[model samples]
Target: MTALSPLDKLMPRGYVRQMLCFPSTSAEVSHTLKTGLARVLADVPYLLAGIITSEDRKHVSLSECYQTLEDLYSEQDISDAIDYVVIKQHHFPPSSFAGPGIIPTDTQPPFPNPTPVFRTKLSLVKGGLILCVAVHHCTTDITGFGALLKLWASHCRTGASAAAGFDPAWLNRKALLERPDTSNRPTPASIPELLHVKGPDELTKIAALASQPSDPTTGVFFFPQKTLQALKHAVNKHIASWGNGGWVSSSDILTALLWSAVLSAESDPMSDRKGSNTIGFPVNFRSRFNPPLPPDYLGTAFIMTTATASRDDLISLSFHAGSSNDDEPLDSASISKLADIASIIRASLHSIDEERVRNVLLYLDGASGDHPPITLGPRHDGVSIVSWADQNIYGLDWGDIVGTCDAVRLPKLMYKRYPIVLPRVPANPAGDEGLEVIVSFDRQVFDKFRQSWPMRRFSTLRYYS
Candidate 1:
């Protein structure tokens, strides 16, 4: 049995699942879908199995490494249950897909002690098909998920033998664990510290915030290619002023814009207190380490990094709060702020060089396997932006059986404070390339946020009922 690595143990006990909806022209395609998915699983035996945990929660291994087809795939007919368009409208869905219940970590008898960590459910609806796959975070992250999708799509198009071409069994974390640690010692700043809520009061506050009395609403806003280009041009102009800002990617600018917007929408009194609003983003280290990991290093090879700026600085740089005139054009006061935001983000990400990543690996290498939670997301103090821009989610195709990808559905917002950024598929085949950001806030705060011409000028917004 392959053992779970130290990095795997640090993953929060849960699964990150995505619901991909497709337009189905035939109702008799279930068997074909099942066959394709089975082929997909057969090629990746590790994911078709279950996780075995020792008496304590410290150790985990893959057990029952080869299970029956039923263990991996489930099916249900939900044609008359819900509207498919509602799922389509959601740009950035919450993490909880099926329901609100958390996946049980400890063993529970009679119900399958060591359950499968990776699962696929095909929900057949009237006009469309919903393919839901849930894989524990300990098993893989979004990058790995993308790999599975590509392979599954290949299987659906061709057959199991073709799917084997994209199999990732050879890219496990074992190699990372076996590598020697020759990097310098890690300083406190080199490692990520936990910021999980402690005590009953904090939990209660988070629960209350999640379940707002007014029921927070989530909106998907689309940013067109022209707007993105304009923002990049502004950012580049500002970067030219700095002696050495390096190259700021599209994701850097997009994340900086969202971070600034979230800060502007904050209602907390402590938001302006010192470093009240810190922005954190996840850095993918697969290609950043000394001896860079292979492109197929499918495990969790990412680290979360947070950059703190004064609340005033963030708000001043925010699109909504920068210009304060009814007739002011979108570009009046956005250049410097956009530039500043991009600079801060670029600097934070640049700090995670080969040596820095090696230092973090070494630090975790010596830990007790149970390290503190890596903080990422909209915190009580600030907001976190997770960018999946590099992931080819829009390119998923299930052959001619399911036709083209109808829509990528994200879950609903469980927590109103935290938000997600999703790069959406273009409106038409020739429409502008763009991104969709899903955010939740109080009705009043969101109202103020949406009203800002600067925010509205760059994108079109749609709220979920």
Candidate 2:
């Protein structure tokens, strides 16, 4: 009776929603998305020939340009909506998006909705792409997103010329949620194990974080490879601090090294006593629950904050070096300590209590409410709107980043969905297994945080160049 949805050909799919700023002044958000998607739809089977693009070392841009092209603000606002569409860009022909053939149970979570979730937006400047791609979270992860991104970027590099189906599907919350949980889950542990925990009563809000910088304004650029290498060197040197009992997690090591630099920048920026914070690793909470999430379901799996601690009394460390036999380094943890902290975080993971979700969601989701900043003083309120975003790297294949005979291969469904999913190259051990980083922050906080830690002089890893 109803005309089949065009994307039925691309079943078992995932979604990637990105907000991009265009060189032009056009304000139609959906138009930009359509411009990109439509370009890919053209003879993809022939043009790409299974070759995925890799945005390996590109630094996260602050903006493509400073001036706005020319879209009416009001009209842009009204049309600034998202559209979801299905396209078969993964595996080839006949059975385009057939059953992933894994276990369907993955689609089922303890929550009322069993479907996997996918949708995210990031705006660097006044105009960019608000990308939205739909995929079954049960089968795809950020790794897939990386690959998909390559495909999209490829198309963009080629041009935003439309093919047959240049238009996109409007993002329908109900339709996405209503989809069946047909994930072809392979392993049991791969599936989420539902764990429940009870925390303090109705979390009106979690404590806020704050830090003082010598400068009132500093440019915060993504770290470059040299900086990352220097950081690794510094941490390795610190590892020599193994006295009676020295320990730290990879997270702790990285945070300490990076934030220390941030502190240094603050000291130089001593224009006045300005306070700001730099938070990283908004870790996904997938494994935290019972029946871990399927490697596929591309939802907002987990979100955790790793704050700064340079204050004299607050100088603490939490790194976990691997076992004596392993190079992983001791994870800022001990046998008993791990069990205890796991239980604590696990408790935080399970407790759904809507009140808890609502309150904690503020900090977790980066809500820019009237709540004051954590360690800093008040003035943090007027920053701006509390919009949200994440550049989840876990979606990529970071584990087996080492050895490689050829190009990195990703699940077909994912390559067909998002704009920026790809594999790192020259192959390293990290690729054997992928390591993705999910960075979530409150936009308001980010603005304030940016002021304190100038990214202007900062850079990223060589891999990212």
Most TM-score-accurate candidate: 1
TM-score of each: 0.81, 0.30
lDDT of 1 by residue, 160-278 (tens): 56544763544567666455555444444444342232446656876886466666666667778777876687678667777774557666777766666666666463444345467
Clash tally for model 1: 3
lDDT of each: 0.63, 0.27
Best by lDDT: 1
Q: Report the poorest 10 consecutive residues by lDDT, candidate 1.
A: 100-109
TM-score of 1: 0.81
Per-residue alpha-carbon lDDT of candidate 2 for residues 1-465, written as tens digits (9 for 90 to 100): 111111111122223322222222234434444344445444231211111112441111111222111210112221233211111121011121122321122222232122233222222123221222333332223433443444444443345435222222211112222223412322222111121111233122222222212111111123334434443444444444544233333333334433433333323333443443323233443343334333322223333333322232111112222122322333433223322222322333344332222233223223233323222111211111111113332232211211112222222221111111122222234332221211223333323333332122222211110
The true-structure Cα RMSD of candidate 1 reads 4.8
